[model samples]
Target: MTTFTSLPPEITREILQYLPVPTLLAFGLTSKNNHSIQQHSLSSLRLGVFHSRLGGMISLMEATADRSCLHSVQMILPKSECRKKDKVIRNQNLRIANVVEKYTHTLRDLEIACWELQESAAMSLAQLKNLKRLSIRLDHPHTRFSGLDPSFWETAPGSPVWNLFTSKKGEKGKSALGRLQSLNLERAGITDYQLTKILESNPNVRELSLRKCVNLTDKIFKILAEGKVGRKLEVLHFTRCCEVEIDERVLDHIGRLLNLKELSLYGCYRLDSDLVKKLNDEQWHIEDLTLPSTPSSPNQEVQIDPEYK
Candidate 1:
């Protein structure tokens, strides 16, 4: 009598294709046979690694040491985990490093939410040469105290986090981040100069978002308006980034982003009412322009989906 495991490889591939990503992940963890089939059948597999799931994630990584099935990754740390002692956070970073290093060849999209990334894990992340999209969400006061310097670009040699933002120097000058197309950072505490370095390094990034990045000033907008990223940038968001003075000079610079399709400045209170009107009046290519309500108008700020179009 034939069994499901004994089915022909082509039949198994078809069946696995019908299953959703979550189901495939669950079934892959059930046995070696299912894992093999899942790996071969799916072009890419999604992995969600949380503090609670770290042990199981590590075990799976050990079991599939030779395989590179995980493609998209979301690593999130809970509030409780963030509040843990430094030793626990360090251990967690080590585990994250192991998992990231193991799947560098296949991992493409990564979203990390933690108090901050330690150097070890950040270095491991920089090794993902194929990474195309990245999101970093850091908690406020904790990040300030965790020795997480925002000027990663100017860090010392073997600058783990800086490596993620820059291209490796070689004959080809290939960078792990050369393929990046979208970047999002929330509460990053990065200054304009630091961010300019990042943008200059990843000129291919098409979508850029900065939320509560208090250190940014008009200088950043000036860079984008004149930098390589502006040539290709299609989406831009500046939520709660109140320091940027979006005056006529900055507005003119923004108009130079010929490819920009969407623009949002929600919660950026320093915005002048006339600038908003000017943006609306300009004959630009922007398809979506979202702005915070004026002080006279007590309404909610317009919200846009973070996902790129």
Candidate 2:
């Protein structure tokens, strides 16, 4: 019988990648060979870093030192109230800064959720050179249901925090996020101007999801239709949002996205049959579509186009 130590290094590393983090840590203690395999397996991982401490999801930034080789990192925060006394929340700003400084050059996908704007985290985020997928959720856990102020969306271009991820004037080769393909913003206080800047910065994005963002307005959709931003978009989702009304014309404009395959609009009470007709008439390419379950008025019912299967 062959001993585990006698196995080839490739097989050892492959097996290690699937092991639970605690188990992997335990294996790392067995011998020098096991430690080397564990390090190799962890360096190339794609991790979903949730706020919860469950299952095998360990914080990549906390778990490894050389995390630059990571292909994906999803940072999630609980929608429910986070205890103010928790060390995770208190030291989060410092941890985020360290992670970004350590791995900015090779980082790909990044997802961040902050109860409030921490300058350190914002600055750290700007340093990522190869980020492809970015998901930002910026609402306080305690204030999820409270109405948001409109002025929160009006961000100035000169703001250091906003400028970090954007191209400086006349300093262009490619976008800071040339590799970006997907973006998700939830309750992030995004205004038309800020959204335009982000879209312009990452023009190649194919999938966009905006949820519970109260600051986005109809004019933003108009911009998306008229500008180059929506050209490559294949999937779009807007849910539980205010200020952005999904009227018939908006749907007509969205139909221009030739590559669109999935369109989901949930709790946008303003949507009606007119929007459905436009989607149906234009031969929209959406293969999956979702609409609000409850119409604004008791007499109205949402109509889904049969062609979109």
Candidate 3:
């Protein structure tokens, strides 16, 4: 009978991939060789905390740290067992942020889906300086989001996330937001000032998506179309955002962007068909556009299909 550690490297990797996350961590602790193998073998790690409690989530974070080599992770926040009670969930959110800090060096892509995103998690996200993409979405509990989150980057005065913006060169250097190329915020009620700060912090960003956001007025869109980031933005997508009418003048600036390759306004209530046609004529570089079939009528309350695009 051969011991488990006696297996070849290929065999060991295959085994680790199949084992549950907790079991894999426990196995890694058996020896240094096993630990190294776990690090190299793990590529895509997705954890579902919806089944576990706050304490269990902490244990999971510790276990993941032990295994090592986490490149991409999507953590789903645990659903409320009692619905009304969210104390445990808040704790779990903070713990998840701590886990992110542990993997900050190695992680390139991180996605967090939760009911209510706590400030701790948002702060921790700002600390990451090596990530290429950061996506946060509010799925349950809080549907209408607030951009006050990234505002932490510019506001709060003394918070860590805020400090990172003006921070001098550290282990990661002055580039506080890291190598982030894409930032997607769904249902995040980000204000004009908040979005501007986000762009200011992340100058290298090229792709951006704001979906199901309620407060995205024309001012925000105009900011993106004419701001410094506008020159570099290649993909812009806004779905089911801004119930109020958006001026054609603001959207015209977007149409003139030479770098924009993809543009989608699937469910915007403000854009009429004529204006979209004018944009198509005025813009020479837009290759992908998701516009509504017809212009929205005044006082016409109709359901616009967000998935139409």
Candidate 4:
């Protein structure tokens, strides 16, 4: 009765390391022996905790609290597109804070797609000094009521989450999350000013995405084209940012990223695809390029080409 799980633990562990999260989880549920393999592999788990199963989140967190190898977590909130009561969202945010506080030291990649962002959750994120990749997708049902005024695209004063990116008065220009290499914020209520500060803090960011952000102008792209930031960025996405007056200057700024491998400007109605075609013709080794389907059509299907000409 020789089986895969019957192999030596060392060999099993080595094989399990190559398996992705879903496969590993499935293997665990197959048999007691496989479950044992999964338990040991929790140290290097890339976990995804769904909103429907949040009641078990604490149990899962408690189980892995002692393991120093927890590397990534993706938290998806329930009813992300609909309105939720303030109290319920706050409580859920507290749970998020708990998860952040628990894995602060070991977590390197974290993604949270929720309806709202709260101060406690923001404050907890500030503690993850080792975090390398972070994605926050906030699909707020009511931006104005939540203190995110769309007209200004401003995170009001005392907003703890946005504040985390700001340098402390005495830090001599050090950013709170200085170790971030990849940062993605979708539909976030942030302005050019706050985003500039965030970019200034994380000088090593290679992948930057600001999708569907309402308040941005072309100024942010201009900053990205400058000095160290432009030189280091490998991926840049500014999709569906309707307000931005993206013209030749912004395209030129994006073109200056010498190391850029991926660029997405989908849903940018103002950007001329001919300019993108010109940039593509220049050929700077971009592996992924997504452009608007039409010159002024927001709903047009995006044209994605790895070797776009």
Candidate 5:
């Protein structure tokens, strides 16, 4: 029975991988050896926190600064506070921004859930040259504040956060991301213009997930399916994105993406039987296809026979 303290640093680090973020952080504080082990594991760490003790977590995250081991950080806001307005929330965001600014060079994957995204926060994240994956969960103003003025959605283009990734005035086009690969805007109210701008900048993306993004329309999908941007995309997950209706033409355009291997249309009720049949009959190289739970109607049955490519 080897105690954690008795194990070598390499062995200790391997064990740390299986532990939760908080457990690893706690173990790191036990001794200098444990701390070093934890630091090494930080590069592969993926944090998913619905609610955590902010002070302690921040301190731990900061302590691993020199290690520069973080690859992904997923911050899930408390469901109760998702729609509430509070200064503390802003402070917490500032703290996150501070951490990101200090270590953007090492961070690769970032996910944030917030009531609204400020320009400054986007700007801070844009500085991360190694970022490959991003996910943003935004609470719609309409859903959060029923009967709120519609004008609240209208913000000036030059706003600090808005301009963060956008080209600065009087400058040639420059992308904030250099190595981005996958982007997920689940439930985020991103406009077509913004999405195009991002795709144009990160053309090397391979996987794009727009799950539950009600704001996106068919036009956006048209652009994506055409492979005008994200030509290298191989996996597309458009689950529950009811706003974007997929017609046969759109499906045909998607089939043209020769490199696409995985297509997920879970909960997309707009996709009819014809489109499904076309996808099943097409001799494309798609290896995985995900659909929603079926209806009881016999006519709605879609039989996907397994055939190895």
Candidate 6:
């Protein structure tokens, strides 16, 4: 009577690849045979910077080699809502780059949700050439969701992170993120100027979301509508950006987007849904428009067409 681990190494490796991280990790603890399989198939990793330690991170990074089918990598910080200490957060922020550099070859989707943008770590983004979906959410506990505080948009010197990939002419050569597709910067509190520079850099982007960014204004959307990248964008999400007061002019600009499929603008009281319906003179290929839900309204239940999905 032979056990599952008694199978050939190649056979065992193929079977173990389909298991989830926890199961694969558990198998590794059972026997040395399972450890090799776990090492090879360890493609994706999701861990909180504060919840885990550096030694564990180093071990995982070392394990990810040519045999490892690395697919996605996410390195997120503890949320500000949890009331974490500043010193702890700062230390974690500083160490993110060191941990990430270990697996630059395997990285694809990268997300960094923190109270403040880790400028140092973000500067090294160019190294991750295969990164496609980038989500950078910077939200503080005290920062109002309705509008951005002045301090959050302090980019007079310009953000090194924003400059990392956007510039065609790097000090050395072309940086990473040339092939990026989707970018979401919800609640980063970036101003129009910084947004403009970022858009200018990533011209091939298809999906764009700036949800809950307090400092952003209509200017950013206008730029998006008219720019080269703006034309190619298929999905646009500007939800809860109360400060982004858009009128018919702005709507008209957005209406020109030829490939826009989904438009989400929940909590944007300033924008008129009626105008959004009527402003389609150019006949944009829009499929769905998501708005805010209100119990006060007579039409309490708004159902999106199931076919749209």
Off by over 4 Å in 2: 1-90, 139-163, 167-175, 244-246, 295-309
Candidate 2 per-residue C-alpha lDDT over 168-230 given as tens digits, one digit per residue, 9 for 90 to 100: 334664345555787777666566676787788778888889876666767767787877768
Give each model's whole-structure lDDT.
Answer: 0.64, 0.60, 0.61, 0.67, 0.59, 0.61
**Against the hidden true structure, what lDDT does model 3 obtain?**
0.61
Top lDDT model? 4
lDDT per residue for candidate 5 within 1-309, as digits (tens), equals 867578776776666665666776788798887676666554343332323345224423432122244434546455454343444346446655765675465456666554456655676777777888776544233323332355543321222343446564345586687577877665555666777777877788888887656656667767886655535678888776665355444566666667877878776776775557556566655788776433468678677877935
Q: How accurate is candidate 5 locally (lDDT)?
A: 0.59
How many angstroms is residue 293 displaced in model 1 relative to the true structure, after the best TM-score fit? 3.4
Higher-ranked by lDDT: 2 or 5: 2
Span of ten consecutive residues with least summed lDDT in model 2: 55-64
Question: Model 3 over residues 77-165: C-alpha lDDT tens digits?
Answer: 44443233366447656766777665555456666655446666666667677777766654332122232244332221222333433
How do all models score by TM-score?
0.65, 0.63, 0.65, 0.65, 0.63, 0.64
TM-score-better candidate, 4 vs 5: 4
- Residue 225 of model 4 has an lDDT of 82
Clashing pairs in 1: none
| Pairs with backbone N, CA or C atoms under 3 Å apart (clashes), candidate 3 | 50-78, 129-178, 145-189, 146-189, 147-189, 147-190
